[model samples]
Target: MDIKLLVKLTSRAWALDILAHLHRGVPGRQATLLAATGAGRTAFGASLQHLMALGLVARNPGHGHPLRPEFILTAEGKAAAAKADAILRAAEVSAAGLLRKSWTVPVLALAARPQRFSGFKAGLGAITDRALSTSLQRLEAQDWVAREIDLSERVPFPVYRAVNAGGEISRVAEAAV
Candidate 1:
């Protein structure tokens, strides 16, 4: 649940979904996982490959036919899967999709309190302004984040804070940290 690992896990669209399903005891066959995650074959395959590259997932040798291999979580994968499950559980089913986005969880994790735009940019390191803006707008639309205008300064600014399900997700993300 290190920040870097969390960022890598979220880099792929379906990686966390795959991990959550695996942690929930779903069979790890490609088809089974594909069905469970509701992910397309190619994207799911890519995410699965990404997980393997991260050493969080590995093929179970001698466990299945060559054409249909079974995947097992490595020890590190189990820990990560647990965190993924916690995150998904914290989010509403509809909002789970936002969690799949690159910056959402990281942003939420940092937004446990109100923050300015620059605060988020500084904390997240490499996120582009457009990406951060899009993620914030989406979360705001979902009512997961609330944006308030700060008029105290000569130049007005917007501050973002996690609310509702977003607050829960932020708690989970902070706990992982």
Candidate 2:
């Protein structure tokens, strides 16, 4: 989703992980934050600065013994997270494709049966012939899927099949279904 946490964080990957961890009830502790971020102590401090400056996180003071700092989302931070959630939900609604997050269902469907052009179109749901062809071609180029050119008559038909079988997209497709 559109968590501006993504926009605010220094590295998109770490930012996303941190926000997701928080959303899942992981409280922000220094050691855990470092682990979650995959950041060295020095880098972690820089990241924390960004998070704080963005108003998405703050130091939780009460829990510390010798003044150790526990990081937490401020109200504004939570609001941003919520907004991100809403943006993600809205995208799923509008695009009818959450494949970016979870391609499991679609990936499985494709894997279970790589299809000829017609069948592929039907399975993918309401894709235009041109877009469908383009996507198939692109997937073929990426080696994620293969297209065997079928030619017996006037037109060329291609049957698609999974190449990697279990990449990120495949996992997402599998999860979706």
lDDT by residue (80-146, candidate 2, tens digit) is 5544333333223332232222222243335545578777556655457776666666555555676
lDDT of 1 by residue, 1-177 (tens): 777788788999999999999999999899999999999999999999999999999999889999999999999999999999999999998768888888899899888989999999998888899999999999999999999999999999999999999999998987876
TM-score of predicted structure 1: 0.95
Off by over 4 Å in 1: none
| Alpha-carbon lDDT of model 2 | 0.52
Query: Residue 80, candidate 2: how far off, in angstroms?
Result: 3.0
TM-score of each: 0.95, 0.41
lDDT of each: 0.92, 0.52
